[model samples]
Target chain A: MNADQLADVVAGVSDPEIDVGLRDLGVLRSVSLTDGRIRVHLTPTRLSCPAVGEIARRVRAALAEAAPGHGIEVVWERGAWQPAAVTAAGRDALRRGGYRVAGTAPRCPYCDSEDVEQAGRFGGAVCKVPYDCRGCGSTFDVIGTAGCNAMLPTPVRGGSR
Target chain B: MPHIPTDSDVYEVFAQSGHGTALSHVGSIVSPRPDAAWHLAKETYGRRDDLVKLWVVRRTDMIVSSAGDRDLLAAKTRMPYRQPGFPTARRRDRSAAPPAVAAPPERRDSGLTERRDDAREPRLTDLWLALADDLFVLGNRLGERIVDYIDLEEALAVGSIGQEALAHAGTILVLCGFDQPAVDARFFDRAQAQWQVSRVVERLTDWPSLVAGGLVIAAAVAVLAERTAEAEPGAEWLSAISAIRDEQLVHLDHWRRWARALAAWPETRTEFARAYAEVTECAGDMFGARPQSQGQGVPAAAPPAGPALAVTLHERLAVLVGDNGGPGSRLPDGPRTRTWGVGGSALADSLSRGRAIRDHYAPGVFS
Candidate 1:
């Protein structure tokens, strides 16, 4: 199968934490095909995401139908997850899930409070930040993981705060 | 979410915006029972009239109070009141008579919290750089301790954390507008005299204390990162901070797991306690620090900035170690605060001694 078609297959794999596929969450950093091997580099929303193994397994499971008998090795890459990596569709998914995405300020996932503030660093895990919604005064976790915070190549411009 | 759909039976409403996207929740509608809920929800939230589908779920089914089981919910609720952003609203309009009503800094539950106004982000950027310096040093120390790993897993985990830390430190250095050589000069080559990291960093005689100490330090940094991210100056660093925080999540988990595993043994508690004592001052200095230090160098006093991180390291350490005392309750009961200064172990030592000396000479230094 062509890389685009194969990518679509792996992209369909759902993120266990958030209800979006790897492609939308932007964790699917790259997918390439060479010499009868399918190489997928996935960025875990967090460094120690417990679902790393599970996500890889699911990617393998999904790829079976599309690229049967191909070598699929999921390599977790360096760019720590960033919200900017999230596609527009992924953002809609987050908003629909009651998580608000405002500029640098973390919007409340539970209350959609635009007036949010940081509650703590370790939001239960590495890829999450504990944020308190000023509107509801309730603290909830926001997905802090995305592609690397470094500015992307100008052409691939998907900048998010 | 009980408590969420309080007045009536809360039915969650999901709507399809168009084709392609899955049905997402628009809003909720309250009704006497489940049947009438969807109809009311449609009328309430479907006013846009573009929805192709809708689904109402009993709010009870969607109640996720977080991954924390019944036990941790209480402690989790008591997170310190410091708002985690390098709040831009404060920076955008600095006039004492702000035309717009800004978000109140500490409205949560009368906790002594850091207000958004006090997080002078540009100044705090400097603090973050200082933090990067501290982390670089600690990461180096942690890297050295990789040899003390109980197993491959421990070594791998600690080694990964150390590497991530150094990388984060590099990012912060870059963010501080430093060139590579300057970063190398400040972080790698020279000693940040003010980085009085809690002596516990050096005192990590065993694995448990090391993990415990790292946990407290990470928590303090996490809080700082959150606050900084909320600020205007911190916009560029948000993604980096978030990514770094993700590593912290791993660090916290590994350390907590390590500490907890050791807790089964008797000596680990003492070790944990020792870590707490050693790191507590460093943690305090790291957050609500006074400008002076154990080093003879003078501290530059900015406007009386609130403790960047209002949470007490002692309390956070207590909870992490399973003492579960609940935020330094057993310690002197008062508003959460510390003498604001650069974070480090030596700073912790200097601060403690400084507090004593300051009180001795000035008598009312605290008062």
Candidate 2:
């Protein structure tokens, strides 16, 4: 299989917790075929992310099925993964799944109201923070900046805070 | 009347979703007491269906390293040996396996020869060993009293911190060229006098004493780790020391929080103050001046000077207890002259107690 086809296969693997494809989540760092060996690099949302092993396993299994008898190496790159890495598609997928992406002014997922206050800096998972909506009287988790200060609202990219 | 501030501190909450999952920082809450912090954390972060366990630590207790410290975290050279995926990657690419361990610098011989005239001077290896052994002893010491804490949450926190200390000690041992067996031997078989743990760690008698002594020693270790990293640039162990220092900062914060909490209440304040004074009395040598640099010949870096470490510790203690004739008013204004080193009996006793417990449960498994 060509590099593009292999990339497509690997990208199809979704994060088990969020139910979003690795490509959309911007975790699939890169895919390249050099000397007939396919190399795929993944960057985790957090260094201590529990889903990393599962994600890597799924990527490996998918790639192996797509490109039979080919050398597949999945490398985990070490660095901080930012909320800005999330693709627009990833954001939409998360919103549809009742989650809001951080790095933007978080709105209530249920009512889409801007009147939201931080209930907790932490949420159900490491990458999420809980926000309470005044309009809907409901609490929703935002896929916030991993391992960064969740207390402050992350300024939107290329925009004033 | 003493002005007791009513404002609560922010406590960061970490939670484990399942039995085997790693605890992740889920969020934070504002609370006055550790118990109240835990309850607020549960309400805030534990609304989820997956929550299994929780740990609430004061946010201010965290010692965050500055941006300049990032260089210490960065790998100046590629260290494929440390990476878990390196072997598989090497096999897939038909490349050779990287060396399992990097050789530590040969500063010991030079350090000794240069300081031959000054027989009292410790070699760089000796200082490093002292730091590691101290942590090992402190960690096991904390483990012995985990069940003796006032509450289950405090016990759990103490247990977690103890495990962290032990882990940090193990990392330092690896940097000192110890393989797994050597590391195990160092923990289980080292003779008592050979241990270089500070006297403060050996003197922990109760919960208040542990909190006070741990605060002092954790701060000292953080200072020593920073000084060691600064002294030995480009060394293979720099990264390990950096990581240890980072965690040591957290441990320092944890202890500081407990000290402040205990001191805030009128009932516990006196007890904590007495414990702090006792620990501080023997903790003098921990911040002793750097052995006067053996003139010109020593190639090894001098261990961190005592005054610099003492200044920082005094400042932290002053903050914990107000400077206005508060609990720590009796804190020494300058580094004390007395030398500090626990006798081998302290370590021997600790080991015997640990062994007794092990033997009680498993019946000679440790034997």
Candidate 3:
């Protein structure tokens, strides 16, 4: 398959933790078909990402099934992954799933209170951050993994506050 | 199979300020349940200091753009005022504000008190905690759904969704001011010890949709080694079992680390850990029982006792600095700069003071 098509395939892989696609979530970095073989590179949000092997295996198997005896070489690129905002389209899908996308300020996912604040770096899983809300005065976790914070790419220097 | 449209969830997050400022949104939380959504929002958004509140909802409730539609870029025929194109410098400046009062400094907290008193009334820390919690839960959810794929395109979509969930969650966490201790440290130590799995999904070709599908089964085996051992399954099911095991392992690691850190401090650690565990339970139930209560969906109020880590840290710093008199008084009163010998003194002092105030009223909560 072509690189773009291959990338689409890689992006479709689901994360066991959050149950979303890689492309929409911003995990799969690059997918290339080189020298009669397909290579996929990805960064995990956390250091010891639990789903890496699973993700790779799934990708390989999917490609093989789709191409029928296609030689696929899925490579795990080294880098700490950080979470990224989904494309506008992805956001739409999430909205359909009964979620509210942040418009002005990023809102909390727990109490619907705007009085929420960040809590910890690590969420229960690799791709998330724990937060707390004041209106409800409670804490919860958010999804994150695969970009600057995760260590794969040097995020825009000093981009996030 | 008929195409089932996905639903979007809305997550509300806020930020807290030390000087009594209303919490503001840092990011969002994604979840099917309002209670679980909000709890996750708080943890993800408010892991740092001075947090106050969190909010979350389903994307379906929020009005937004969709994936299939290309209308976002449709050109406006008339009414230039309504269009959101580039604006002249002067117009841009004027549009942003009345153009009378000078822009406030980025880090300045000038009208904090007034803002706190405003109808919005959210603390800075609360906003952050909620965002963080939202992201964490969303990430976990992504893990649950992304595993065991059918084809390349689907796999890519799964990874994309998972990554997006994580990114939003991270934005909330950072903006809210939570600190990550070990960048490379996995969330769960014990889980990691048992399983060595990766979080990146790489789909090359088309497979199937079910977790029991062949592609998913292979992925599961490669990713979830430990869980495979725990589940007695035939070789045919190895892939699927492994996929779940791997995802759980990674997820467990993250939770374990988070729990341990929240519990590492003095008084609040236990409560923090306990509350956090309840909020993001693996089984989505009781910590030790079958009928677990995740604060009934909304975040349970801060345990009667808050985290004592701040208090203990404060007390320890007080004793240490008190004995040494700390840095011989050369530190400046502005934002602390150095982490060197005397530089750390200010941080210690600040921690001590805040802890003292919080603990004075609550006692054992921090003492």
Model 2 root-mean-square deviation: 23.5
* CA displacement after TM-score superposition, residue B203 of candidate 1 (Å): 3.2
Q: Could you give candidate 3's per-residue lDDT for residues A71-148 as a string of tens digits?
A: 787654333343334666555554344232322333544456666565544344444444566777666554543222
Give the CAPRI class of candidate 2. incorrect
lDDT of 1 at B35: 75
DockQ result, candidate 2: 0.03
What's the DockQ for every one of the candidates? Answer: 0.04, 0.03, 0.02
Top candidate on DockQ is 1
Q: Give the poorly placed runs of model 3, Cα more than 4 Å off.
A: A80-85, A91-105, A110-113, A119-121, A135-139, A145-161, B1-367
Runs of candidate 1 with Cα error greater than 4 angstroms are: A1-161, B1-122, B192-202, B289-304, B307-367
Give lDDT tens digits, candidate 2, residues B1-367.
Answer: 2232333487878999998889888877788787788878787777766687788877666765555676776778876644677545644553352321222223212222222223354444444555566667677777766544444445555665676677667666655566656665566554443345666655665667777767766766676676666675776445456555655665676676677777788889888888878777666545442232222211145553344555664455444433221356344665553222353444555655554464477644433
Q: Which 10 successive residues of model 2 chain B have the least lDDT summed?
A: B100-109
Candidate 3 TM-score to native: 0.29
TM-score per model over all chains: 0.39, 0.46, 0.29
Interface RMSD of 3: 13.1
Which is the better candidate, 2 or 3, if ranked by lDDT? 2
Ranking of candidates on TM-score, top first? 2, 1, 3
